[model samples]
Target: MTAAQARTGDKNCRVVQWATGNIGLRSLRAIIEHPKLSLAGLYVYSDAKAGCDAGELCGLPPVGVRATRSIDDILALKADCVLYMPQTIDVDDLCSLLESGSNVVTTRTEFHHPARLDRAVRERIEAACRRGGTSLHSTGSSPGFITEAMPLVLLSLQRRLDVLRIHEYADCSSRDSPEMIFNIMGFGQAPNPQAEAGRAWYLREEFGPSLRVIAEAVGLSFDSVESSGQVALARKRTTIAAGVVEAGTVAAMRTTVSGMRNGKPLMSFTANWFVSYDIDADWKLRGDGWQVEVEGDCPLDMHLHFTVPEARKAATTPGYTAHRAINAVRYVCAAAPGIRTSVELPQIVTDLSAQA
Candidate 1:
């Protein structure tokens, strides 16, 4: 049976929040507060977080939902969907959940477009969806709405289009993940073209599919996708929330995945991430937030900014990521069983009734 055909008579959609990291914690809070959703289960990776109240984990009063470390326990819950948010991508774990008959919405970009995945891995996910009649969707702040969905929405206003460029500038010093900063981002490493090439490859592996997804959604075709990356070294030793960065090490990096049509750039996905304010170079599109620029018969440029305390700057991105996935839970549960994207889902409406 398809996901739309599957019936759940419950008034409130039962949801299991998987993982309680930055994004997960925010998602848990949103789920508990959303009137149409119920916090059915809490899945955690850390033993310390086990048995703790879900509300306490998010710095709120106890809401009676306790965190669990066992995957089996989460699987046993009668949940309509799972908000899967973890630090890293784990296809095996995601497949396991889908195979157990739970629709999923995740911030992980790997599944944003499963067509980019290996034939074997993609087939495995498809098989799981077929077996359980579930749907899985992947989204986030940058690769999700910023680069793909938002640009498409803006382009719809124009009568004709030629080029689209999405630029993201973020201060990464507030991020708490050392592994993500050092290993994945190569933040503290010495600059080398070969090493930078590897980082570019990682960018393509992560966001390339989403670019392709956008291209297809807009009725544009790309002959090839090209990736390029450059890094800015730190001028002085720096200390931030994540860890210390030595002088002369990598501090900031800019990467792009461009779709080439007819040997010209049709669409470009550019990201500028910085660990410290002081770097060899400073590049900002509009002094902060996300910038989307389109060149065509009617040229247009937009800058999206969020107002928050200086200390809470880092949390803004993750908060947006969580809400994007959480707000799509209902649509994901009702869509056809398969790997889905924002293009296939309904417009996400935020529940502002619970907001202060």
Candidate 2:
């Protein structure tokens, strides 16, 4: 191996799988089957999944790795990188992993733009990076690929730019994670105007940094990145992958974050997520995918969609986010210490030889 490759990881990079949720489970399988990676350990939460073999969890033969619930156990492993895909992020756990000298690539949207992050949290992460000389990065499909990566590619073709708008549509009816769909996403719940408003504000905070990242890239200063949200109730009872959405309950939600320059939107991202189209609101629901439009000197429009039949969507959708995190393992591991935004890292080059 070359010096740089050795410093990061050899061809067989050792990775620790952080969780086994929908996305994490897909990541787990990808890592195990990856020709360039080897599974070092697995971390899971519930007692039922704790002692189970990794291969059993994903329907492969036993690979001899067992899942554990303890973070300390994970820290003790000799892993070059940790594919951290938990639903909620724990800052202390993140810091500990960095301090353990393992580079981290997470799907959480928190570290997309470190400068826009809360001052105290940013400082702590930086300190951990300095001490351990390890890097941390946050990436996923929406706030990641459609947010930063694709925009950069499109902007390079333009001399003068006007506005870029990204619309993400997800038919989440096939998602099997009940907690994610029901509690975290607030689907199947009666709307409280106040609670919905709070959720909107939370969405703003989550996506605002991404807008700042784009603003920084384009050399435009924004007054602020603003956000708003709207919700639609179910017109009748609808059965989804997770459970039931009764009439008058939240079935669809749309949240938007816009980068405002001089009190006007310069760049915007809108996410449309729905369990079913039979809703009280006449939302123009598209298939599960993304749409990007650049209205500028050189206008560009594109659509990215999933062609998987609905029967396979539940098993296949996680890969959309998980694969990116898996593909970024090498880039983040070799990066300089501190928060590595998608813009800072090298282009992700994948190894698909295993497919042959």
Candidate 3:
């Protein structure tokens, strides 16, 4: 083995995946199959999943790693790293995990910035990592990597800076998220009293974290960001292979920011899934006498639609996002270890096809 490989081997790093849901399962499948990574443990909150074979539930053959519900078991196994999904909202759980001396990577937006966290909790995680010689990384498919890092990368091509705009349009209804999430994004059923209570929409909270990332990437931050959403009802109902979906209802919402050089937005815009689907989510750039248009499907095989008319780009775009995240992992891992917001992290190159 090369010197670098030898060092990495000495660590004997093993990963513990913290969840087994959709995103978790996908991440597990990807990480487990990687040559350099191995499953140390699978931690689930549900008793039903406990003691199950981790790989089988994740749609893979057994890898000799069984699911366990005990955090102590995971720590006892001496896992070098933990890949955690964003499902756990319990601050206490976070504190305990960080204190366990295991490095962590998560998709949690709440941990995007240490400033946004409780001072005590932040100090605990930071102190734990410092004492244990580990790190904590938090990112998402969007805010965590793509929209933030992609813009920073594009700036390398520019001679002068005037304005930067990053756009993300997702047909979230296309995903199999929970009903509360669907309803908040104006999907699924109509307005009901119970639904209203569950209406913590995903757009701003989910997408806003990326904006913060972008600002930090370009050495800018916004103090005041203005956001608003509108519900568009379809003129007709439609159904995909998944199920029937209303065509029109809360069709879209736009979020934009314009203000300070730090957190202020020179300009910004957001289009809800419904609105963007009805319209177009192609990326556009106009600067340095250069105009670039970007739009495509995600890169996942299931979402790929080469034969389809509109969605050929859908499958391609997400793959772009996913690839960017994977590529960023090396940089994030190497950077100063702690729970860092997007801005706190160093600028990462976004070309997934690039060789390390």
Candidate 4:
């Protein structure tokens, strides 16, 4: 543990839930229910959510924590940490929070690897951390913790290490975001190599740095990183919770990013996200949940599966993403001031008891 973590001791960590979106709502609930944490403030971007009780926004009884649309109010609150969960990352706003001496735990993809951030932005974050003496940590579902952090933990038992592979097969039919499903994911678009290449570039830049973190943690030097993607066309026109899926349009996508050493792949991350089960029935929903495969002297393969009610299926992804960060608040608060990753933090375990 770093000096920051040691200084935190056993006090109840006060937290502000910033933004109450899908993941934010889950985070609000988690912070309220966590044994070692307290929900001190709530931040909301939507006018509709403002002035509402945090618990009510999360479908629970009022907890006396009212949501506010004002960032200034959040900044003024006496809190130890903020669970930043905005849809789009606003670096300036984040830096402001850090500068106010509040440690941060976010599910933002861009912050997963601070080194991957633009030079200017990276330096700004570091400066803020130094000025405020606070830390920033990021984690999420697939690209965040499942693929990178979890695999690294499992690899600790290995007597020898050669290659690491992580896979995620998600059925996103129940997701609530229509724009994300249809527009951003190209769910109803024709296969275009140029567009696919653009997506591959995104995957590479988004996840490549994370793979580098893993490589460095395991003492491997990677020579190159490559990204590729394939799309599965819809078998037939279908309608799901998100939107319509036209036949011949993209129904499923498989994106892979690999880190290579000495001409062989050292680490690979693959995500198979789909809106329906018809696109590639054989491969769709194949894994129990997330899978990590390692090839070494003590070869190992592991799967993580969760059973949730059908009504809550759409929330599983965001819920896990929120918990990954929420559960890390204790460690992040105690770590040295600066951007930190799951690889640097201690193992995060969930504690649901009322007493710390």
- The TM-score, computed over Cα atoms with residue i paired to residue i, of candidate 2 is 0.90
Candidate number achieving the greatest lDDT relative to the actual structure: 2
Model 2 per-residue lDDT tens digits across residues 190-274: 8867767787788788778887887798788789878888899999999988998888999999888898988788889998999
Q: How much lDDT does candidate 3 score?
A: 0.54
Q: For candidate 1, lDDT tens digit of each residue in 185-210?
A: 78888988988898788887877788
Candidates in order, TM-scores: namely 0.88, 0.90, 0.72, 0.90
State residue 95's C-alpha deviation in candidate 2, in Å: 1.6
Off by over 4 Å in 4: 1-10, 237-239, 243-246, 280-288
Model 2: pairs clashing at backbone N, Cα or C within 3 Å: none
Q: What is the lDDT for 274 in model 4?
A: 85
Give candidate 3's total backbone clashes: 38
Give the C-alpha lDDT of model 2.
Answer: 0.87
Q: Per-residue lDDT for 23 in model 2?
A: 94
Worst 10 residues of 1 by lDDT: 1-10
What value does the lDDT take at residue 153 in candidate 2? 90
Model 2 segments more than 4 A misplaced: 1-10, 175-191, 233-249, 278-282
lDDT of 3 by residue, 137-252 (tens): 66655565444545555555654555555444445444444453354455544534343223324445555555655665656666755554434444456553334556544334
lDDT of 4 at 152: 80
